[model samples]
Target: MMNSPVETIFYIIDETATILQEELSCTYLEAVAETGENLFQDDILQDEVSEVTKKRLQKSYEEANIGEQPNETIRKAFQFAILKGMKENVQPNHQMTPDSLGLFISFLVNKFITTEKQLTVLDPAIGTGNLLTTVLNQMANSNVHSIGVEIDEVLIKLAYVGANLQKHQLELFNQDSLEPLFIDPVDLVLSDLPIGYYPNDVRAQDYELQAKEGHSFAHHLFIEQSIKHTKGGGYLFFIVPNGLFESTQSQQLHEYLHKEVHIQGMLQLPTSLFKNEKAGKSILILQKKKEGIKPPKEILLATLPSLMKQSAVEDILAKIDGWIKQNK
Candidate 1:
């Protein structure tokens, strides 16, 4: 919330970022390529939020008398403040992940995470890095390595700050995920695929070559990319618009999954669960087929009403967990 008469802008950024990271951990580094008018220029906002930066940040926190509030309360206040300030004072361009949806997806995937020494998770369009951070929070474990690829500079900066503040080891990149990219394939691929269409001309010539023309949604391209970058036998949890299941554009994707991947489950999310958007969403869980293994013939699919509670979501996941165990 930079709009408030904050004597120090760094303070708001620092405090609000605490929610993204755990307390007193040094597992990340924050990088912002440039500064905006609302955040001051390079003269004030520089490469890192180090001890010197905190001194400036602390002054504003003291002025606001935020020393007495618990970290959670402060985090909530700071999140709203930044969100409001960004909307009212600064230009709006990015979408933030809702806390409930972030946590819900994380909760659904928790059981699948393991103590494997080389676990790696990737989020191709990691806006603000909330979903990945939420996954780490739910696990409350530090053994996993996380990575995110984002195109927006500002969102990646915020994500880097949050990952560092939480003391979680994260690798962040600012690049177009739709283009030809190189990263070692990972074990788990998680994403809230950004909505919209990619330009037919700019899209890589051979991207998902099987998809026909006039079927050029960005989300479809991203899903294809995620599948390519996922290890055999690894898993993917994508929160995509429900339209993917019905759209003719996604016919190629459906065919590919039917032949090469096992549809673990699909959990329909509440409509309007995401702020500022009207598309119905669902979490599609899939596992890449290892060599010599055939895809499962049956899939587990369920829907939750818009009015369902957190506990109810948990119950539904528990049922899905049981099914996974039986089928595995």
Candidate 2:
């Protein structure tokens, strides 16, 4: 029932009965990275997702014009794969956790942007466009606009269709977020930044030895780099695991980030949030500001809920919304 990127972006998911994929792609450990496989082979996106699910999914992608995004490498392959899985009655969670999306939306709707009356957002790291899709659903055509950037060309194309389906005016770029990037000033910025894991190569030679300890130096560095363009006072959010978040051993890396940005809040997620083989996960929310007093150290943390559990997504969303409204 969704029509355009603006209309369909977040139209498909029902917070009550969201399913999850068992394993996220092991791109970091795999000898090779197959963006296509990860994009299409997701368990939840399979045939078991339901006709209503497929319809919502297709509507979201179509509205965004994500399929027609500026790259031929991406096609309807991801969509086809999801439906194919559904046809077989597969009900696994895939690359992302729809259950956690409500928490994120609560953050986006209230804390992240200056106002919900109007918004043009950006997600630099759009994997299969899940987070952005979730954000779109939360915004619900309330004059909230969006743009997403993804390194994987294939996913960008799939995201284009999903994003366009929501009636969002999206511009997908086939480029790494680390490189000099450009986009119009936006009110909100959300991303699952590229931690050193996941088949990253930017710091291979620079940090191969220290790879086991934490994210590469390049990733830590990129955090500061991306913040440069994020408008002052604009909200910024991303995930970093326990190894990185509470790393007394790796204090230098995150400490530098703490120094560079004014952290607004943080969500110390449980390890289960990352169904992938990765060590752990954490969610951070900060603001891009030119001048300001440091954010409180008592950074209120939202505990990471089970990403793959039989729970009500809206219940979680309501909890988050209550927090957001209170914060304002």
Q: Which has the greatest lDDT?
A: 1
Q: Alpha carbon lDDT of residue 15, candidate 1?
A: 50
Cα RMSD for candidates in order = 7.6, 11.0
The C-alpha lDDT values of all candidates are 0.66, 0.52
lDDT per residue for candidate 2 within 1-328, as digits (tens), equals: 5354322312222111122231332222110112222223322244444666555545443434443442211223233343433444433312443445434554544544544577777777775575666666556536776777777654565566555544456778788665666777776777666655434554433432234454445446445555665676677776665556554436665555565566666666655555564656666777665676345545545665665554744565566566655654
Which portions of model 1 miss their true places by more than 4 Å?
1-56, 60-82, 89-93, 115-117, 200-202, 209-211, 272-278, 292-297, 307-311
Q: Please, what are the lDDT tens digits per residue for candidate 1 over residues 1-328? A: 5443333433454453342223223311222212121132213343345666556544543454443433233334434444653554354446666777777777767766554556788999987776787777666554778989998776787677556545568898899888776889899999989877676544645665335655477787888888889899899999888777787766677887776578888888876575544567888988988997556556778886553576876778788778767766
Query: What TM-score number comes out for model 1?
Result: 0.75
Evaluate model 2: give its TM-score. 0.59
Cα displacement (Å) at residue 279, model 2: 3.3
Cα shift from native, residue 167, model 2 (Å): 1.5
Error at 89, model 2, angstroms? 18
RMSD from true fold, candidate 1: 7.6
TM-score of each: 0.75, 0.59
